[model samples]
Target chain A: MIRLRAKISSSRGQSTNISHKVGTWSFSAFVILLLTVIFFPGLFAPYDPLELDVINRLQAPSKAHLFGTDEGGRDIFSRVLYGTKDSVGASMVIVLMASGTGTILGAIAGWFGGRIDFYLMRMVDVFLSFPYLVLAMALAASLGRDMRSAILALILVWWPSYARMVRGQVLSIKERLFIRAARTVGASNFQILFWHIIPHTYRTVGVRASMDVGYVLISLTGLSFLGLGAQNPSPEWGLMISNARSYVLASWWYSVFPGIAILLVVSLFIYAADRFSGAER
Target chain B: MAQLLQILDVNKTFKSGNSKVKACQEINLTIGEGEVVGLVGESGSGKSTLANLVLGLEKLDSGSIKFEGVELEKLLKDKSKSFRREVQAVFQHPLLSLDSRKTIAWSIAEPLVINKIGNSASRKARVLELLAAVALDEGTASKYPSQLSGGQLQRVNIARALALEPKLIICDEPVSALDVSVQAQIVNLFLDIQKRLGVAMLFISHDLAVVRHISDRIAVMYAGKIMEIGDTDDICESPIHPYTQALLSASTFTEESDEGREKLKLFRREEVPQKGCPFSTRCPHAIALCREEEIKIQSFASNQESSCLRAQEIFPNLAKK
Candidate 1:
């Protein structure tokens, strides 16, 4: 009976391992396909994203137009494919810049502590007290209606969370005995910060940065949807959705495809971050 | 012998809200060149605080710590690199003393790197030599702290401490965290290193037996004050202070007569007196004078000193035993 039970448990473990492998392979494939879409939209796009065919305007999904045509008779599939760069690429840049700035500021604050920590943390608090979207909207509006302004606004508002997190990590890590050991071995403050303290925060910062990509994408598109980002004719995901709103009742395929594109890409990034964080544990 | 490190009337107090704990007070001690002075105390005895003070990790409130005729504060401010290179430390937890992310070779080479002593090739060679000195194999250098056993990690810590050929090394309970079996090996390794390198050491631990094995002299501390200090043989055989006598009688390795054990009571947790000896509250032979008068360490003909006022009368009886 014991032997039979052992065999059953071993088979169950094998099945779970196989399923895990399958999940990992498919996730990798999806990421590769998304990357290709962002970098070379011309490869899979059947029609010129900007070319118009007014005679077939508002056409539903058909053989010639896989995702049908917008009110301008532009191919929804091609537009969504091209919009990947402006939406997802912009989000990636924003996450990287914010995390980089935050890591440096937080490391300095936590390492020096005292008045420096107090002042820097107060600055972070000032940014954090405001509602993220409201602050981003105000900053975006003041900078004028463009994707660059929207991205800059998001970066300013997003960095404080990273700074706060990295600071917390540094506070705990600085107390570790190895840091004291480093000091006894003649390491200066700067050397200790860079070599001893900062390296320990990388795994945490990397996980947070990956997770922030999805949120930044949603915020960037929200700005575009509100007419404060990407202007018109830019093929940005949120601008495409905003344009399709007028004809949504008559032509559902136009907005639905782009919306699905946003959902799929956002979920993919979040899932990847989850897997990365889990892999270490 | 030339004095290597002198700590005179040093004091440190930690204040949090309304309570104040004196971690070190009027602590006078000296380590000579190529000397091993064991500082043994129970938990909360402030031996670690003194180690931190000598390592320049904490500021002294009153007294001066002179290392080779230079004030500690001046050495730290003007020639910190040289000062740090001359004095290194081995902490209690070996794994905690090493950077977990770095390999053993990198950890050992860190001091050399900071001081810019040699190129990467020479540093690597030095790391190998250090590993062999600690009885660790060459392959141990490539492994991380987590991959090795506690004893191996301690060997790595010792190797790192020895990388700069420091003149003095402060060991803060370096072997207290290891297994009982492994503790002997590490203690022996410290003895071997001291014999070969002739580096001065201030070894701190609560275990008297371990300290006696490796220390040339012994100092017993209680409540941030040294109760007695002398040659290891003098302390073990004729401890004048009631506190030191209790410590020696309590150690498991020492075969004490049942009558001697009965004479010394187990240490009780009593509030330390503010004006008198710190151990007077729990002393087996404390008189009114012990609690009322400010007691100082009294010297004896045997080259030992004790803080107990009655140590002169106590010593002859202890000698007869």
Candidate 2:
């Protein structure tokens, strides 16, 4: 999603410009929704997310329990509210780590083409050869099923895609006449790469990165569902789903509600990416 | 001063899967200090490639390019800042050359900033001076490259090239991307700058009239080689080479006159023919001998050379019109 903003702005149009554009509809939609969950989770979540009421467990949707009670007797709606941070935070961490590393490595490989490009691209290919889910699961399982481990595993599995994206962008941007002009004007290779070449590749990288957020969100959910992500008792949508799958037939609200929340957040970002990419100057 | 720059016995080739493109071959030319040498050629004649070679952006396959008797490659190998600061380029596209997001002030001030020439205040002062010289209003400094028109952006590009006070500016079709009406203003501005600053330039364009007006000397390139190079009047008024004659005549094809109408006659030329002689495929008067082998440059008038073999036989007595 951030990649979408990066794509439109060539250089120095980073976070500030994104907010100016996102501030229009996104502040109201994405920011408001996420902030409500982050800051005022209690306002949206009426009942206690952690307090167990096993006697009221498996309760159907009612006025008191809007999303119904789960097998653990925890309020599904309240748990989702609390879980929002982990679900979104994991995606943010992976996206930031992956895209940031990917863009830098890609830019370096593209600008300093030759052996650097060959080795870096080969490494990317090798990483890509491993099935993303399998590799992420292995790392998460090996490291321990924690949020930090999940994020680390996902970042390791994801950065190659961004690196490839940024490398493609940099390759095209470096060939442009402006880069040569920069060199002719006595710009050092570093200056030319950072100031001239890398900035121009932002749009393509931005577009690709923006779309990947949804994919990343889905993958993080998958990781948590497999018990390699936000573990039980955490409100993370994936972990919540994992906790409620046993009672899904009797109380569809357990799995269905968290799924809907994931859908809503993912849709918000996808829509935001589309809207921000449209705001290209 | 001694020759500002010299290219001797240069050659370049690009290999792609089974075939090769001879982009430049045995190209030799010289630019004296304060001289504007216009390099004219159609697209695919390696004009831009030549510009890139001159700018030290590409390596020469063979031969040598020298600046004031020093090897150009060596100067670059030594990372000589003065060599770089002394030479700059203005590309064809206006907006592409200038960073779109950066303010006009920063774009013009970039060279000074990159070379670390002066403090911010002096750099700011120089930016304003460049803007004024390029005839851009001070208010334009605040705007971005996207906010300006094609001509205004090109002016900004020219101003940036001037920021370092370069001794040579290689303008590769700088005005070609602009509208015809805007071209005159920019060309005249270049002439004005050259006269004032006495900066040598290699102004490249396919437009004969545009090049003829600004260039003290004109070098006509065909396929990777210079077919003709001489004083502008010598090439324009008495154009000895067939290619030069064809180009000058073709450039004026829009003039509503019988002469203009007559000069529009072009030989049916293939896009790329498997031939040694660069112009043989398109030369209207090409004979069996002209197609048999490669032709070397044949000297003519003072400061003039033509690679056209039949220059003596075909135009021995062809006087200046």
Candidate 3:
């Protein structure tokens, strides 16, 4: 810990500022570029992702079609660029839901304790007992395969971990003397939980939420990859990859680019989350 | 002068497993307006438990605490929140008592904000005023608790307690966790605040010297019972209860030579006899009756009493206030 602080101080004393470091700039640039592609896919792609050209099926990379075309003759590159929206968007939504629900439950459970904590934490434990992907797949199968079902299943399988994390954080903080003093000062339980209590858990929750975003992306993509996500022709990255399975040997461009797209976006989030957590100490 | 607070036969008991621990047993005390009553005891002597009871942070198992004839629970039931604003507490641990994530300004302004004392502009003004009152610099308000020293954090804690202009403050070992130098400064600050604001206080501490310097009257406890209660000087010079005599003698042994040490021999603990005097197992003057019969509090002077059955026999010449 002392060494890290000394290294940070010495680096600042020298010429290389933290933001100007190569690793920081490159990671930041990659994130910014992914965001651009999500919000402005039209700007990046000349060809429409859904515009089918069955005539040019199984074509590899060329000048006119950089990532070539899928078996449906849809342009792979434009679709991959467009599919950035769901992979990033769904993960963010799931994280926000998980963190929000988890924090509230955890705060109440930890603060009030006794029976509320007992039942709530037990339920969380039950949800957590299952491996996340298996649970997500089971829920998707039961709820019927669609984007909304996939999201619902993911949120159900995910919120318990966040609830469990924030609950643990809140448990530690509620024991602080200020919380008891706050109660004495006539701050209602609501005010004490939110103002004096929950904010203390934010740093940990931020780190956890960042890490969860990556896991959510992976789970959603894996579900879609197994034909449980947005059905064919929607250009969602996972569905796109699933559609390319038959032509894998003939047209490696089809599965590989979309696969890289998923891998790149997931790592970007994980890296950001890792750095976010490291700075908290 | 009005009696500001009254704790009448207040009882609190905790069940550990099969047996019960009487945290506070039939405690009776009163504080006049602007009076500082120091309740001193060892770690398991229930001083903190009594502080919690008076603060209404814990529920009393059997008896009642009242402020100006209104019961504590009734005061809490009303929606006005006047009772809450009127009572505030400063805890022992400095850093633990202030929210680490919040700026000092926000912490000091907490009670005012919770009670809705004024609009944002006026609240900020009061926060600044309190910061000055606690002897903190204006720039200190912007910093988090971690950025400040223990003494600085404690000053902020005091400022927060003082924000509502509370009528009674419960200070639970507020300076025990501070340095010896900082302890004097904070104690003096507390005395100064009490003089200026005329807020009554229930100061709980295990330090006899700190209690003696600031308390108008002192109550000494042993095993969840008040062993001695009287005017500060009267009790210090001639403590009626053997427990108080042992305490005063113990403090003297720390500073003086071995000359007066044998006057009060410290008692060793035995099993707490549930039906008799709580101190019977440890009292040097204990008779068979003391171990078998319940000991009731005997009053001596104006508003002073002790639970020891031997109070009159031991200190017959003790002067009345």
Candidate 3 structure lDDT: 0.84
- Model 3 alpha-carbon drift over 4 Å, by segment: A1-33, A53-56, A118-135, A138-145, A271-281, B252-263, B319-321
DockQ of each: 0.78, 0.59, 0.77
True contacts kept of each: 0.84, 0.84, 0.92
Q: Rank the candidates by TM-score, best first.
A: 1, 3, 2
Error of 2 at B321 (Å): 23
Task: Going through the candidates in order, state the TM-score of chain A alone for each one.
Answer: 0.88, 0.83, 0.88
lDDT of 1 by residue, A108-209 (tens): 999899999999999999999999999999999999889899999999999999899999999999999999999999999999998989999998898788
Candidate 1 collision pairs: none
- On TM-score, the leading prediction is 1
Tens digits of per-residue lDDT for model 2 on A3-33?
8866766566565566656634662576567
TM-score (all chains, Cα) for each model: 0.92, 0.84, 0.90
Over 4 Å off, model 2: A1-24, A39-78, A207-210, A244-259, A274-281, B251-267, B270-294, B298-301, B310-321
List the lowest-lDDT window of 10 residues for candidate 3 chain B: B252-261
lDDT tens digits, residues B115-210, model 3? Answer: 888988998898889989989889998999878998988899889999988899999999999998998899999999999999999999898888
Q: Where does model 1 sit among the CAPRI classes?
A: medium
